[model samples]
Every structure is written in structure tokens, then in C-alpha cells.
Target: MQQGPEGGSKHMYMEVSRQIGRMAAKGARVLEFRCVVSELYIALRTILIASVTSLRCRLQKRMLTKLLNALDAAAELSTTDRLDEVIHNMVEVGKSIGSNSSVEELLAQQNLLVRMLKKMNRLLEEEEACKASCALCSIEFLERIARYVPSSTVPIWKHMKASIINFLAWSDSRVSEHACWLVTTIIDGDWVKQWSENSLEKKKFWKNFFALLQADSLQAQRLLEEMFTFPGSVTLLFSVTDDFNVESTVAKHLCCAIRHKQLNNSNLFPLVSYFSEMVCVLKDNSENESFLCTLRRLVKAFCLATSDDQSPYFSVRNNFALTIGAVDLLRQIDELAKSGIEIYKRKRDFDNGINGGNVNPASGLKQCLVRLIANLTCEHHGNCDLARKLGAVPILLESTKLDCCNLFMTQWAIFALRSMMKEDSGCRDIISSMKPTSDVRLD
Candidate 1:
């Protein structure tokens, strides 16, 4: 048959993919285990390469059917080593397909995904050494599927949640980590928003999700510990707590409390306690950049949480803030500011050869601290008073005049000054003294 260049390329790819599939199928039929595994790996690799080269070129329906048949045949093999090899190969292929395939294309091959999930579930039910390997691959494959076809695959994930959670309690950290990702992805991804349309269902899902988060399993706690070390993790936690639109409920409530001139939400105490624990850890390991990153995220999350005080739930927001211990947060911020200033000064002295100490300047951390202070005190008289009492006003004023201060730092310093001046004349006096000739209006 005559063909154009595009048609010729498609024909060539289909023929090659079929040939590879045939070779794999033949090897499996003849009980040549090694050959079957090798051919399957090669076939999947070839498909992956082709997909990457041409995203529009999907697996031909015939080729996909052959591959699925090969997977089914391999799953029936009684040998553990063979099963593990097959499952591992399946994982690679699934990952490649998930990454390259469009949502519509993935939906068309839903049967393939379902079969893989069923096979993995069967293996997990068998109390064998290979279960962990099988479970890991399956969890990862499912996660990939969710990422690619989130809307269509939501039901499959919801059905598999219990099993996935079981893997969270597995002794292996890697297994637990994958399970954590799967759970979080299912809840925090775009699909959850669509799935939770019914208010009752949304309430039930959140309640159950929180229960899962608060599970007593050691593995669960390990996941939380791992997440706590990262910055955006708090925002993720907050998304599940209140509305997905706001990053952190605790942060939002704290901001609301400041605005309403009240701090009394009992429900927020646990979050405050959690922050306090994080602060203690931060103090013990101030040199760790990861901890600093977490702090930066935490600060930003709080800023976002408090940014929206105009919500209809203003009274509830105030209650949340009231319980969150303003004094405790102020102390944490003060300590962070002091440490940041020390680092900033050390870097300055070293640069000028005035001190022999070598320090890595953490400008980002300092900026986060200043931004957080500004957010906390922005329109809240109570926070302004608390900040001044904690000596934040002087620190903020100093930050504005420092040679190292960037535009961001200057802007936040100006914000903090504005807030502090709202209820304290001393803050206005300090600013006026700093710039006597300039027209500095505290009002």
C-alpha cells in the first residue's frame, strides 16, 4: 500500500512493536523464563523510547493487547524471581505510559491498569518475601496512574485505599514512603476536589483522612516526621484540615485572632503544640538547611492562612487564633530572628575581614522571618502590641537600614513598622528618628 511519511512512520512503529511483543509471547509460551523476561524488558524499553520521541504515538491497540496478555502469562508463573522480574518490568512500563499518555489514551487502556492492580493485590495477600517488592511496584504504579488520569482513576484509588494504608504499616521505610505518597496524592490532588462534591461525603472523607493522619502506627508517625522536615508539608496538612483553598487552618485562625483582638480557640492548641515541637527541633539543629527550609514554608503557610480574614467564619477564626498561644509563637519568632541576625552579622563581619568566623549567609531565612512578622502584625492591634513587647519593632527597624536588606526585606520592614505604629507611639518615634528629613507618616 502507498503511504505518506507520517503513515509510513506509524506503520513502521506498529510493526516493530508487534514483533517485540511476538518475541516476548513466544518466549513465555516455550517456558524460556529468562528469554521471556529479557524480551519483555526490551519490548517495554522500545515502547518507552518511542513514546518519549513521539508523545502522540501511543501503543497500537493490538500491541497493547499483546503486552497485557504477556503480563497475565508472566503473573501465572509460579517462580518468585520470575514474578518479581515481571512486576518490576510492569512498573517501568506503567511509569512510562503514565508519563507519556494523554488522559483520554490512558482511559482507553483502563483494563490494563485494573489487571495490574488485581495482580498486585493477589501478591500482597500472599505472605511471601516478594510481597514487599510487589507492593512497592504496585503502589508506585497506582500513584503514576493517579497522576496521569486523576479524574478517571479516582474510583479505583478509593477502592484500594484500605490496602494502600496497610502498606503504610509495613516494616520497610521505602514501602511506607510510597504508601504515604499514594494516600496524600489521593487526598490532596485535583481529583479529591471533584470527588467531594456531596457535602456529607466531603465531611466523611475529611474525618477519615484526619483519622488516618492521626493513626497510631509507627510507620504513620514516621511519615509525619518526614513531612515535618519539609516546608510545604505544613500547607499540605492545612489543606486537609480546613478548606483546600487555604493552606493552613491554624495559620488562618492565628491571623483571625490577631484581627479580632482575641486569641482563644481551643481546637488550635494541638497545632500550636506541634509548632512548638518543631521550634524545639529547630533550636537544637539551627545549622541544618532542611530545618530552615521547613521554617520558611511554615512562615509562608501562616502568611497565607492569615491573608483571608474576610471569610464569613470570622468568629470561628478568632476562636482558632485565641487557642494558638500568641506568646509561644512570638517567642519562637524572636528566637528565629535572633539566630538569623547572628548569622547575618557573622557573614558581614567575615566579608569585611573584621571576624575570622566563616558563616553561610541565610538571607532567605531572614526574609521569611520578616515576612512572617509583617503578616502576623499587619492589621492586628493585639499582635502589634505583642510584637513590640517581644522586641520585634527594633529588629524590624534595624532590618530596614541594614546594607544587606533587599527590596523584599525593606517592604516587609515597612509593613511591620506600619502595624507596630498602629497601637504604639514608640514605634512611630523610632521610624521618625531613623529618617528625620523624610516625610514619614505613621498614620
Candidate 2:
């Protein structure tokens, strides 16, 4: 295959590749196919890495894929997740293979799997066209190693982490989503967390994660609902709350709070309050809408894990945050009306430090809080119901009347309420039945 600068060789290469895949899938001599493919890859590693010919790079990709199918067949791929799917797939493989294959044989295959994943991870950087497939398959291979493998702890996946910022922006949703899961596997790994040498690797993963979350991985929006539930991840994002990279990360963390196990309300309080004090941290580039789209998932997992939460959103001591947004906005509205526009304008600025611009008084704070609530509750009727149950409906209704210094307070309220109606009929009924004032009811 490497000798091909020849014409029409492309079609032959593709056909041979397809046949190999078919054979591998059928388990027809898969072990021998894996061995031959491994030899071919080793022979052409230099060219494949250089991608001397785009066609050759593609052929190499197919070869790697064929290799993956063989491994999965050897290990079985259908079941991975409660160990979270992929890992569970591996745990089951480890269990079943113990019955069928000798310990030495499985260990040998495991070593080879790690080497392949590392090689593919490196090749992924150079192979854009097949980057997604390369990454997806590589991650699966690594997950197959049972938790005890020392190689599993190494941050061999580190090279791929740097590429994630770009992956999150790709049009291909799987690329970004798989990238997320890859980083997640790294952080959640027992070795990565337990080892002292890899502490830097763990921190780097968190930094990358929040950075992606802050930018809002649009293509991987579905992945976010399943993201950052790992404690190490949550703590790292919190420890750096003041850092700008974490701007939108806390919101992602907060929304996932429902998935947390019996969190020490004592520990959770400081974490929640710390973010509330810096609520202005979230940036516009951060779209809080991503996870609410999976409201059913959140609601399903909602009471499944109980935490002593102070609000529908966060559990904090003194419990001031339930109406946290409400209090701030009402105070601003009163002060803006009473203190006068110029004074209020002179008093505040958004994302501003000392001697900042005379930006619109509502530009950052008002817009942020309203938009945060709206997006947080958007497609999340359980949250909307929680808000109403906590008396937020009347507050949100009162908020609608405020001009918000031309920040569209009414429009935002309408958006928030409309989003609430989108997912649940019961929440919609409760909202509709309420008459905020003689002039305006939520209907």
C-alpha cells in the first residue's frame, strides 16, 4: 500500500480496506488481521505520520479503524458505560476475557492497545480529515484497559487536550463531544486522580475543560449535560473561580449539582456562595442554554442524588441565593429609579475595574442576571417550577415591568417564561394561572 504513487491505486486501496473491515467485523481471523495491520502500520509509520500522501493517510486511518474493530471484537464493544458505558464495556471485557483468555494473553493485548491509542493520539494532530475517528477510536481503546493498568494513568492523551479548543468549534458534533469524553476519562481515571506525578495533568485537564465550557462547546452541547460531574473537575473549577477562564464554568457546574451525591451541604455552601458573590463572572460568550435542553435528564437525576440545597439552583448556607438574582435586580431597579440615571451610570460599569468606562448601567450586571436565569431555566421546566415554588414567579413578573435601562427586561422575562412552557405542561399551567398584576399575567 505504501508503494502507491501509482495511478488508480486509490480505488484498489479503498476496496481492500473495506474488505479488511468486513473481515474483521465478522471475526474471520481477526487476530491475524490485527497482527498484519499492526506490522503494516509499523512499517509505514514515518510516511503515515508525515502523511506523505493524503491518500496514504486515509488508508492508514482505515487500517487503524480495522485494528480497532478487531480489538473490540476481542474485548466486545456493545457494553461500556455503567463503568460509564465505554469503561463498563472494558470491565465486562476484562471479566469475560478472564474466563476465555489467559492473564498473560490479555495483558499482552492490553499493552498493544495502549501503544496503538498513543500512536493514534499523536497521529490525530496531523490527520484533520480523520481526526474525529482517530480520537473516538483511540479513546475507546484506552478505556478497555481495566483500572489497574499503570499505563492507563499516564496522560498519554495529553497531546489531544491541547487540540480540544479547536475541536469544540468543529461542525462535526461527534468530534467535539468525543473530545469532551476523552478529557472526562482522563480526569475521572482512578490513576490520574490517585497519582502524585500526574497532578499537573489533572489540573491541565480542568483548565482545558473550563476553557471549553467558557467558550461554550456549541457542537458538543449534548455532552455538557453529562460533563463535569466529576468531583476533581468541580473542585478545580471552583478553586479558580476568580480566574477569567472559569467565567462560565461555574454555571455548568451548578446545573450539574443535581447529579452530585450526598454533597456535604457544609462544603457545598462555600462553593455555591463563592460563585454567587462572583456571579458577574459569566461572560456573554458563555451560553448557559446548552444543558437546559436536557431538562428531562436533569429532572430524572434531580432528586436521585440529594443535597441540602438552599435554592432550586445551588445549596448554600444562609440560603440567600434562591432569590439571589431577584434581590440584586430589584435593588438596581429601585436605585436606578431613585438615585437617577447619571448617578447610577457613574456608579457602575461591566467587567470593569477602577476608572472603567461609563458603560450602560445595565449592560453587564442586569443583562447577565436576567439572561442567566432565562437561560438556566430555558428548556428546564423543573427549574422554572422550582423558581415558582420558591416564589420567583412574582419576582420575575415584577421584573418584566422594569425598563432595564433599555436592556429588554420584558423581552427577557417573556423568553424565560416561554422557555418554561416549552418542556412541561404542568409548569406552564402554574405560570399561566398566575396574575402578576391587573395589566400583566404570565400567560
Candidate 3:
């Protein structure tokens, strides 16, 4: 006898629910709680994967509600072993629901999120380190939901930010790790876009956020290290749009922090490391204009961080040279210049009504490359000699002539040329023999 679809689903639901119920009961036994929680997690995973449509149906909804109720009931029981299991299961359930449910569904069950947060707060208050860490795990999973349902979750997250920030400095590495993930999710998610629509609101949020990081050096270092795991975090943090004004604020504060000797090499090294990766990536993918733009902003931030006289790493010249070798940077700059020249030719051909190619001119990227070269060579003798040796003199000269319409590029190209020529008479002779016309102003 073949079972109908509804009957099959009902059978599956009943079996899963019974298993979940059995596990929930077992959880009350201290010696068996860990195994029970693991079994309960498996049961929930089966329900989640069986069929999302079926899981949203009445029977499955009832089963889920039953499971949540069981977890909550177990949470109230204070046995040392059982409490941790209960908390871990609660986190697993929250993660499953968040990953599967719609925003409306998540909003409807806001009480679940609140309960988890309150549990976290209470455990933290009691100084129950293990239990509090489990609660933070639950909060991290809830934050996954918040990333999608920001409109519904932002208000709650704002209320929870203090607790989240406090946990960022927790002595337990796991608790601190979860807290970092939660805070980064909130900041980099859509909610900040909504909250910072007003200029004043944007300024206030960034000011408070950076001030919080500044208040705790170890936490700040941990957060920075966490952010470095993702490639675009630096760019996102420094990006400016009409709705956000934090780029300048972050740059200023970073410079101040460095100058005041408030931050150490450990705090600043991640930025340098990430910057090195970006430079190499940009060299290979010069056609990616968006990535190039982000690279430029990040490079600008690096320049600012290192430009300070009082910076702990006061040997900015040697530090940058060692981190991003002068030879490698010059070679990359040469590749960028070649690409820029091709773009310039294509653009010039298009202007003359010639269908030379379909590529858009990368004048902006060329300018950024030259500007970065100038920043690197400004007072760095090694970079200056490397630029002269890597045949950068010709590239800088070519860049100055390629886009007369783009005074920005022209200005940077000229600055880079001046920097390269400052101590190298051969580079000076090369520029002099080129005899750039009066129209090609070096100033």
C-alpha cells in the first residue's frame, strides 16, 4: 500500500517529533544531556531538510514549537551539565529557524530572539562563563537572521549592542569570537544603511562605534584581526557614499590613534598585510575598476596611517618598503601603466569615431596607481631608486601625457616623476630630455 504525500509527511513529522520529544526528556538527565542535545540537533536538521514547504505547514510548525518549548523548559533547569546542553541545543534551533524562515516568520517569533538575548545577559551577569559562551553562540545564530531581516531586527540589535560590545572583551576566546562576528554583521549589514540615512545619525553612529573600539585596545585588536579574514572589510569600512560619512571619521581617528601611540604594531599589522594582498590582486585584475577603486581608498588609508611622525612604526619608509617590496610594487605599477595606455589608445580611437575596441578607458585606475607610487616614494629613498631601476620613469612620463583632460592623473604622474627624480640624476635627465612641453606642467 502506497502512502499519499500528506500521509507520508505526517508520518515523517510524527516520527521526528517523537524523537525530538524523547531527546528533550533525556536532556533532563545530567549524564545523558550532551548525547540528547546532539540527537535533538540531528532531528531538527532532518526536519529542516525534509521539505521547507512541509516544515512551514501546520504539523511541522507544531513540532517546531514543541521543540522550542522543550528547549526553553530545559534552559530553566540549572544542572551544570544539562544547562550547557540546553543552551547549545537552543542555539542550534535558532540557527535552523533563522536559516529557513522568512522575515515575517522571524518577526512573529521575536520573543525567541529576546529570550535568547536575555539568557545571554543573565548568564553573563551570573559570571557563568561556560553558559554565557553558549548563550553568545545562540546570539550569533540570531545575528544571521538579523542580516536578512534588518528592518525588523535593527531595533533589537541596537538595544543589544552594549551587551554585544561588552562580550567582545570577554576573557573567553570563543565568546569574544562570537561577539566579533555579531558586531561585524550588524555594522556591515543593511541595517546600518537604514540607520545612517540622516547625516547626523551617520556621524553619531560612527563616532560611538569607533569610540567603543578605542576604549578597549585588546578588543580592538581582536576585532581588526577578525575583519582581516574577509578581503573587503577594510574597503567597506573606509567607503563613502551619500548616506554614509564615516570614511573621513575613521581615517582621522586612525591617524590620531597612531600618533598618540594608542595602538601597537599588532593592531596595525593586519591592515598592512591585507594591503599587500590587495596590491597583488589589483596587479592581476587591473580590468576590475570597482576593485581598483576600493584598492585606492584602502591604499589612501594605509598612507594616512603611516604618514604620522609619531606613529609607533615611525620608519614608514622602510616599513612600507619591507612589507610591499619596492621591486614588486614597481613591476605592478608598470603592468597598470601598460593597461592604462591601451585604454587611452582605445578612448582616443573612439573619440575619432574609430571602433578600436569596446573597453572603457581606465584613466582613473592609472591615476590611482601613479598616486600610490607617489605616496610610496614621497620621502622613501629605496622606493625612489627602485622606481628608477624598474623602468617606472618612462611609465610616469607616459601617464602624464596620456590624459591631458584628466588633470588629476596628470598631477599625480608629475608628482611621482618628481619623487623618482629627487635623488636620481639619471631619472632627472630622462625627464629633461623628454622636454615635456610647457603645456605639460609638472607643478
Candidate 4:
């Protein structure tokens, strides 16, 4: 905060404060955020009060219904251009009331959280009151509360359950995404204790959970399946880790389901699309690293199952050969590598990842694909021949070029190419046919 020994730099101090605030709200940091609720509330309230200029209003509650209407309209009272800042400040303190009762105690014993929940519940029940974006935000926000507060919000959560169920099957996965998370949190918190006597009623929650996992949307399915893999979205989702109960492994189940669907050869894309999305947004951080690590493991598991002759899934490879070959995964890899090259040409440079220059974003994807192809070709002479016939040799040779954006390209590409050529007869012929650099024509 002391800028060049000035010792009183408002800008420097404000910058530090903003960073600290962001850090507090990030991922698992929310667990400790309540510790500063009182301090934050004091500072935020002071700013809110100071920002107002003779904007005064008095509330005379004549009836219960009118008071509710007023509270609903009160949201619109803050027409300030800084409305987002004001709402954020309110939520920062209000949501904290779950972890820190001091926030409520400091404000004349008012339960603003309950009021907000009531409004959100109303918004969910009335189609006219909520937009898709508003509904999605509300669902996610409440999921955060359920995570921090746990069983304490079960009553409110149950009240909202009917409305939440309607969201589960909706075509838009964004809304159902957090609704599933909220349900998972409730389950973790043991919200079913009250309904333990009713077998049918208690099982309905799980019925809904399964329904979401098999939702038509692949994204919805991943978002929900990863919960069993990663649990809570508030904290656990951000802090991706391999430390989880494997008995609930949904990725394998989903893949197995795909195998069954492959009986009719339906929806054979597997998780490639999801992997593609992850690669597109992949970053250099522990969170993304752990997530991609798990993803690669899942893909490797599937590849291993199908490639091993003794394994039951070995036959699935034969059954879906036409479907799989038609996918042309190798060609997709070539296109992806080419896209990375184009991106590198446009940027003209590579940027450092979270831990300096130690990490590369697209390299994991390349490595994952290489491992997949390598595993698939091992001991499968037919697959190797197929790969060779599909122009794999030239692709791998091109990949050996210096591609700075995707680190270790040559090593990974060669590993797969070696696996391919070891079982195929034409790789040596292809390598020998290429002319040396000196003899090559520049034109």
C-alpha cells in the first residue's frame, strides 16, 4: 500500500483491498470468508451510505402482503449505476450470515437471507418473475448457501425442491446444473433424515439425481457425474483433486452405457466433445491440471478396456470399428495441432502459465491423444494397419516440427508413431522415401 514511500496512496491501498476481496471469495476461500464478515459489512455499509445523496425513503408497512411487495420492489430501489457493487456487497454480508450470525446480529436482528430466499423462491415459482439467467444465478447462489450452511437450509431447500425438479429436465443445462449440485449438497448434509420413513418419497430424490446424470445434454451429464467425482461446486469444483470415492465412478458407468448404446451404435462420440471443450478453455493451474489429469485417466481407462484382448470390452472395439474409424480421431488430432499452430502464429509468442513457464495448456491434450492412440495400437495389428493407411506417418512427421506453443510435441508424436510403425510394414518405406533437407527444392 505504501507506494514509493508515500505511505498514504489511496490507489495502491484500494488495489490491495480489491485483490484481497477477490481472494476471499475464490473457491474454498469462502469457508474462511465469514471470519471477516463484521469488518466487511462495516466497510461496505459505510461506502453504501456515503454513496447515497439525499436518497431517502420511508416504509410504512400497512399489511403483510404490501410489506412483501415493498421488499420485492426494494430491489429496484437501488437504481444506482453501481447496482452490481451494491448487490455484491449485500450478498457478501448476507450470504455470510449462514457462517457468521454476527452479520444478522449487527443489523437490528433482521434476517435478510430469509427475505432473499423467499424472493428467490417466488422467482422460481412464477415464470414471469424470472429470466433464464436470473433463475440460473439464483440456483447457483443458493447452492453456495447450502454448501456453507449445510442442513440448516434444508427446510428452505425442500420448499424450493418442487420448483427445482421442474428445472432438472429442462433443455438448458445451465439451470439444472446447480440444481443438481444443490440436491447433492442436501444429500451430503443428510437432509433425508426427516423422510426416512417413507421409502418411495426418500427414493424420489435419487430418482431425480439419476435422471439428471442421464440427461440428454452431455454437459449436464458431465456436470452432475463430476459431482460424484468432485462433490460440491462451491469449493470442491474449483479445487479439482483425485482424492475421491471410486465406488461412485460415473465416468465408467457412462462409458459402459455408451457401449450398450453401441449395440445399436448410437451416440458413439464418447467424451471427445467434452474433452475438446476442456482443451479449448484449459489453463495452467493446479485446478485445471488435476481436472485434465482425471479426464486423461478416464479416457485411458476406456482405451485400455477396449484394446486388451482378454478384457470383455475388447469385443466392443471390433463391434464399433466402423463407427470408431469413421470418427477419424487421428485426423481430428491433426486438425487440433494445426489450430494450435495457427493460434501460435497469431499470438507470435507463448504466455506463461500460472506457475511461470513450467506449464503448457494444449500439451496435455496432445499427450492424452498420443497415449490414447498408442494404447489403442498396442498388440492390435489391425488397428496399426488402419492407422498407417490413414496417413498417420506424415501427420506424425509434421508434428515433429518445432511447435513452441505445444511443448513436447516431438516426444509425444514420436511415441505414438513408433507404436504405429512397430506393427505396420510401411513406416520404414515412408521414412526412406522422404528426401533430405539439402536435396529438397525450396520452390
The 0-to-1 C-alpha lDDT of every candidate, in the order given, reads 0.53, 0.45, 0.55, 0.47
Q: Which portions of model 1 show Cα errors greater than 4 Å?
A: 1-122, 125-270, 308-362, 402-405, 425-443
Candidate 3 runs further than 4 Å off: 1-263, 267-274, 281-284, 306-314, 320-364, 402-405, 432-443
TM-score comparison, 2 vs 4, better candidate: 2
Q: Backbone clash tally for model 1? A: 6
Against the true structure, candidate 3 has what lDDT? 0.55
- Compose the digit string of candidate 1's lDDT tens values, residues 1-443: 79754455566566656665776776555555555456656556665655554554344344445445545655566366666665757655675565666676766666765655565555554435345676777777667766776644655565465456456556566676567667655543354334345565444544543444444444444444444433344434554553322223234334444344343233233444455555556556555644544444455444544556663323332333422333344455456656665644412322322374324433355565676667667666667766666666666765575444356667777887887797677666766776445564321
Q: Using lDDT as the measure, what is the rank order of every candidate, best first?
A: 3, 1, 4, 2
Each model's backbone clash number: 6, 9, 0, 1
Cα lDDT for residue 314, model 1? Answer: 31
TM-score of each model, paired residue for residue: 0.40, 0.39, 0.39, 0.35
Give the per-residue lDDT digits (tens) of candidate 3, residues 174-233.
666566566665553344344334565455444444544544544444554444334344
Q: Give candidate 1's root-mean-square deviation (CA, Å).
A: 17.8
Model 3: residue 345 alpha-carbon error in angstroms: 7.6
Task: Give candidate 2 misplaced runs (Cα > 4 Å).
Answer: 1-105, 108-117, 129-132, 146-173, 182-224, 227-233, 240-246, 249-267, 276-443
Q: Compose the digit string of candidate 2's lDDT tens values, residues 230-275.
A: 3343444455434533533454345455454333233444444544
True lDDT of residue 269, candidate 2: 41
Candidate 4 pairs with clashing backbones: 262-265
Candidates 3 and 4 compared: the better one by TM-score is: 3
Residue 256, model 3: Cα distance from true site in angstroms = 10
By lDDT, who's the top model here? Answer: 3
